[model samples]
Target: MGETIRREWRVEGMDCAACVASVTRAVERLPGVSQVEVNLMAERLTVSLAPGASVAAVEQEVAALGYQAAPLPAPDAAGSAAVPGAAGPDRSEAGGHGHAHGGHADDPAEAGKPWWRTGKAMLVWALGGLVGGAYLLSFILPQGQHWLFLAATLLALIPFGRRAIALARAGSPFSIETLMCTAALGAVVIGAAEEAAIVVLLFAVGELLENVAAGRARAGIRALAGLMPRTALRRRADGTTETVPADRLAVGDLVRIRPGDRVPCDGSIEEGRSALDESPVTGESVPVARGPGEAVLAGAINTEGVLHVRVTRAAADNTVARIIRLVEEATASRAPTHRFVEHFSAWWTPGAMLVSALVILLGPLLLGWDWQTGLYRGLAVLLIACPCALVISVPAAMASGLSAGARRGLLVKGGAALEAIGAARTIAFDKTGTLTEGRPRVTRIIAAEGAAETEVLALAAAAEAGSAHPLARAVAAAAAARGIAIPPASGAGAEAGRAVLATVAGRRVAVGSPRYGAEAARGGLGKLAAAMETLQGEGNTVSVVLADGAAIGLLAFRDEPRPDAAAGIAALAALGVRAVMLTGDNARTGAAVGGALGLEVKAGLLPDDKLREIAALRGAGPVVMVGDGINDAPALAAASVGVAMGGGTDVALEAADAAVLKDRVTGVAELMALSRATLANVRQNVAVAVGLKVAFLATTLAGLTGLWPAILADTGASVLVTLNALRLLGWTPRL
Candidate 1:
């Protein structure tokens, strides 16, 4: 009745609302589907079924949607992802909910009363502590009270220590807990109950602290998990508006963007113009100007305009949706640092027990020794040989480190993958989406011949009033921002190119890019190109606007540069990594954005060209490429290390090796730093564990240690290493 199944999938070429709806409808028609949710933003659809819902059925539905489904991703299996709020829909449901075959998060084995925690686990621990304290007081109170401590210890051991006994019997006998439990039990059998209690209680404390660290690191990730806005004003056939969930909005539906409202979806302005604050999308401080025919995003605030918008894409396919999807997918793929304890369990734990048994049996027989003496030596070996320190060290560090990165808005999927590439000495960047802001902005305006400066501007603005071209939009936006009113343009004539000839404010206006308007002015090409270079040199994208056979204005647009680009690059340099930018934009735009942000810029390269550049960089050392969305997907896959932005497409997110959960690429630096820190701690912890084990083993074999001290040393070192690893919880940089 509780049988469960799951699979992963890839959604291709799903760009907007209609595509998402088409796919969602197709997916919902499958057999045995109890419920289906198409998280279009994630480019992944989830289906929960009652019975008889086959993986094949789901695959067929995906095929019908022009996509393919496959198994879920896996890199580091042991490190648990600190998912927030239902794990953002990917993890399915916890608490006995069965996940797919590859890996499922099951309930903790044994009584999971890890120490350093509160609640049920903590209560169990406190009771055990009370029992031990009571037993100790019995010596001072009544002799019969000793049983109280013994009974409490045995009960606690039954629940939590069952796993320890199983672990001891298992192939890997040198495990951290196996060692602690053996030593604790040895002391108890010898009637030294308090030492054993202390060992188990302290071990639980360390485990509890590690869990808390991990929980804290992932504390606020759920804050934005279900932030999808519900209702929106949709414009319809009679010019009437009705409210609907932004999710229900479809393409070509008119959306009303009232003042002080977020744009419901990506769309073109059908009516009105106003200032919009797009800080959430671009991390920019300035309010941008948007007018009729301009593009507005789903998460942007319309500051002053009453925008009547024709939805270009559905709510689930909007920019905000894509951004959310990108973040989720990127986060899902993270890998944590090496888990030494689990890995060593295959050999180290069992090997320790074998040697302990040999020393007890053979050593006493070979030399003149009594059975009690040999038994005690064997017991001491088992007690002090506990690999708890080594076992707990790596996981504790990894959990805390990963959590810390998340708290700072840098989601490193787990510890392993981070450690794999974060220390690379070379970093590459994709210019359009990674180094520069991905959008073009209007920066300057120029005047052409046969027109006064203001008159030419007004005419250009008017002619471009209804354009969607980047250059035209820039000019119009600039004019609108300055409060210049442009009358309706005359009937457009000759649609041979991107421009139209028209009359505005009773003046003839031919508005378009430089190539659109005929060459009527002298040295026009030279003038335009030169102006473009100058602006480009300063790290701005320049487009020439022409009107009436003359170059009327030089319009510039730059993708918002990352504010922390300079600082992040410097940090990477300090870590001995060189940075370079590769972009598909023209040389000027590329150089401008890069130079402004103090990056090494490589511009005017196609997709293949970017790939070649990456291959070339790898010749020097491993390369980490940071980018966002589709254009960078291929290059990201090809790079030695692919770091995608959380604000990019699922394509890029799926391809990249790592992702920064925040919209900016700066998180990449922070993630790498945390990974390095975690790796360092893992190494340090392992060394401490091994060193202590060797010394204790040698001392015990030489009969220089008693059962009491041996048990304490064995369990105490593990507790120490485990606690030390938890220190990474707060080890983040000042990002």
Candidate 2:
């Protein structure tokens, strides 16, 4: 048996893809490092070391490269392992994958089990006590409800408060429990126990709310990951299928998929094909056909016909597998601002508690105020300082925004990304899959002078019908859809990719992936520009036309149009963004999708071209890039803002700022709506937090305010802010 050693480290300053790669390569280059994966998206790097190597040494090595690596953020600090009665971890940060550092997952849970502290039973008990305690105080005694509530509150607080006071006394008061102590003790001392109990009780409620929201926000990714095919049908020399672990699958492995089964990983068909339901990955309702040599994705369903795929990528690194990884990574990564907030509360809550105590004590001693008055005033200050508004606001709003986006088919990976989108005003759309349907479909066939549209299409269809290229599929489908009767397709003489050169009913024709199709077209490249310009307006791909080796007509095809595309783009524009289309397709196809969606179009772009274009667009303003699956991965990573269809591949989503969980184009619009609303709520919460403080300070200095009022105002503000943030949960953009 091999000896295994693992360690956790907080990796820092790696905010880019290159940074991630650098860390990975540096660690892997080390003498004993077997595998080093730096998840910049999760802000953590895990490296498998040989028997004698230390993770700390690797951390130092990465640090030498100017990337910081330290012990992973504590469960109580950040990263995974759940925080409760405090702000929960960002969705991405709370899971297996995140930007935060990591702990050995196989190690024992920090508190014996993740549930020991954050479990539903503890949550229910802790929260129910607060509520039940608050309720008892509020109704049990009218004349001294405050006193009754104070007693109930103190009893509740004592169990937790003593520890907080001790921690604060020990110079570690800034924590969820300490904050509770300060608020509860202040209320009891100042004769405003009801408010204090209410504050703690409501804070508990917010914790419960946090629990529910966290579960919902995380459920989407978990569900997606869980949906992966559990087993694959391995093809053996006997030609029989046997069940096998998907991980054991390798390139060129023969696998079978039947009706209602997902294609196991991305592969090219070597044997059979079918009409596949790629709706899970493409967001298109229509099932698409696949034939010999066509690549099939892991998560796509085979609606009809059997498929024997020769795997192209290993199951672990398959399209769907990578997509899930990306989603997890994106979710785990936190934004710069979120970190600031997390750290801010990690220190602020306790400081306020101390200030409140001084107000209670020093006020009476220095100013000759009544002990009761000073005590009451101190309690008020403590209530105000609970930070219910601050702690709950950011993550709550994020959770709601994420859930809302997911419902609309958009997947926002983390709190930071969700927050970032609200600030993006310019959106760049990838023409192929993001805006136009990625698959090429024939929309129009143009005839040369004196040639009939039907005649031209029939010729191409008949010629292409014998070919297996996409252009052939489009030509055949178009001819059939238009009710044109095609002569039977003949097996052409020539190797595949050269040209399916054949004569259909005595008319010479050819169709191929590239030049062969062009050679068969009559007009050659001369009519290419004019033909493209005309067809581009219709948002379709245009292939060349040839008749007896002279270019004669133009063939136009388009990717499927997203159902809510025009409306989604319009909605984006309404949000004050300009839409631009970028694609790897030829200029004709690019122009076609761009013109239809009214976006500025750039065609024939390589990944680098897409990056440069996005850079230029960002020079004008922040840009939102929307795409689907992995082809859009690079541009999605490059844009000022990246969005992916949730139904698409996870890699694009990992590279994106947001994912349309429902994979509906309109989800992008809804994401904006939710984001704007969340920002508004955050602003309102800040106002409430600061405004109450101003009033409390002024009243205290004037010698007109006491503990009871301060407690009420502060506690009330906390609840109010929490309520406001929750409003985002219900937000909708009429579109």
Candidate 3:
């Protein structure tokens, strides 16, 4: 019984998936540590531990596993989460192991220097010179020329040999470094000293190249952190302006944004008008106009006109900050392919070593090869099956896809959701605020024989004054605009999906669906029934006002469908996805909207009804339920992937798995396409990683490929998959 704390640390020295696993297992074994997640792509580890455990203890455990760990920087008041690659490479600099693995080079001053000047690169060049010189000298010096080759081999093994010995002392005697060292030493034993020198030098060069390519792939994420300005102009109440750090801004503070200045915080415009370039937040090519009451996000450039904006959210909690967090969280989230690769590598490294041993022993016995020939072939087999490429493929692709989606205004929560979206077969959309504009308006008012139109509207508005339902608000807003005075009403109450009741002018007045009026009036609404039917048939949601046992009036409200609803529906259908509209509205209104959008309709659904429907839809395949109301929360959670509209209730947004930040229904199709493409990218990367390893393994086992090609294939596959994954950062659907 202790309190739990969560901490994040940047780890170094992880070259492959096996290193990630090793660090994870070591940290998980510590007392009071409950959860440990290692993000190989981000080079970050998050741990949840009880109060009894200390951060120092966690760091020690990771260091014991042959990696260095350090705490991440504290989050600033502006709420900007540290993005992966924001600082370029592991925080510990791999603890003096040298940034030989792909990351930002260790010395800040030396980073601008050429790669040839780095210690590791210089060593490779030196070994290459020595090996080549000896090979040339052997043609002239016939006596003890092999001694020079041996010297080069021994010199080449120094770096990897040191790492191997260090890992052996740490109890992880079996690692990729150990395997490579064994292969190099085995070459020397088999009288292939020159080949050993070549393999070692080539391996070093390949690693250096891999590091440079991987750094480029990670640069895309780091670029997102630079979008916001460091300082902003604060408008004080005393009519003076002062420039302050963006993080110092608090909610309700007024800020003046001049033309060509980036917005400092997420806020609503209070004065002035301008066109804002929201491409950073929504990826829209054009600038959107902003005026009073319209929200502008931090990081958006104010294109024209000075705007006085009242800060609505702190710097850290702004839309841009949240998007960065979402992207990072998604990148850290693992997919099924990533998990399978990690699991596969757990046994794969050892198994590859065992196979190498078998090759060394059995090749001489079965194929009539000499011991030196058997050892040489076995060493090549070991070098070819390193699994570095296979381990990095899935994570690299996942990070790219998640980052791309965030840039385009789709916030996929994690890698699991990204992968799950590709399999979604059915997408259920909540009718109001999702397919149609959530703004309902009073279009028609029909009064009874004795009731004046204005009188009935005032009474209905009075009865609905306390209700928050969209229909009620429509009636209330219309009454206010028409200058109809609302009389004093008491005991206002709401019945979900039905009516609002209040006592108006000493008579009980009820305003709601026709069924409520009919029941309250005891079947005296015969005259209004026809009018109700006509309005309902026209797709208007008719509200009946009953007072003192008689029907007073009927108000018909219409919520117009979004202009892009049809296009969004068609886009999904073209992708072979079935779109269904679920609404609490009656069948007629639901059908009206669905028919216009060419979608299947399920109407008159209570919240529970929608949940059941979502559950049933899941049986077909993965389902994505899009909604914007509290009633949709259950269904959003029930579906395989829940996509919440940006304008939705907070409950719905929290319940959903993903969110559409632009509040456009068409974004759903865009999101689906992104997910599909991302998963496709993941598959392509996995295939490349796996295919290259298999081909090289076969060639090396047959003695048709040597250590040079084996290491080249391994490094080449890693670079190819990384570059391929980076392509997704620029991917955009034609639609």
Instruction: Name the candidate, 1 or 3, with the larger lDDT value.
Output: 3
Q: Estimate each model's TM-score.
A: 0.58, 0.57, 0.90
Q: Deviation in angstroms for 447 in model 1?
A: 14
Order the candidates by TM-score, highest first — what do you get?
3, 1, 2
Error of 1 at 171 (Å): 9.9
TM-score of 1: 0.58
Better of 1 and 3 by TM-score: 3
Error of 3 at 675 (Å): 1.5
- Tens-digit lDDT string for candidate 1 (91-143): 21111111100011122331132323323244336756666676677888787
lDDT score for candidate 1 against the true structure? 0.58
- What C-alpha lDDT, on a 0 to 100 scale, does residue 184 get in candidate 2? 62
Q: Specify the poorest-scoring 10-residue window by lDDT in model 1.
A: 96-105
- Which residue pairs clash within candidate 3? 78-315, 78-316, 79-316, 102-211
- Name the candidate, 1 or 2, with the larger lDDT value: 2
Each model's C-alpha lDDT? 0.58, 0.60, 0.77
**Which regions of candidate 3 deviate over 4 angstroms?**
12-16, 60-68, 75-145, 165-173, 462-469, 485-493, 499-511, 514-521, 546-551, 647-654
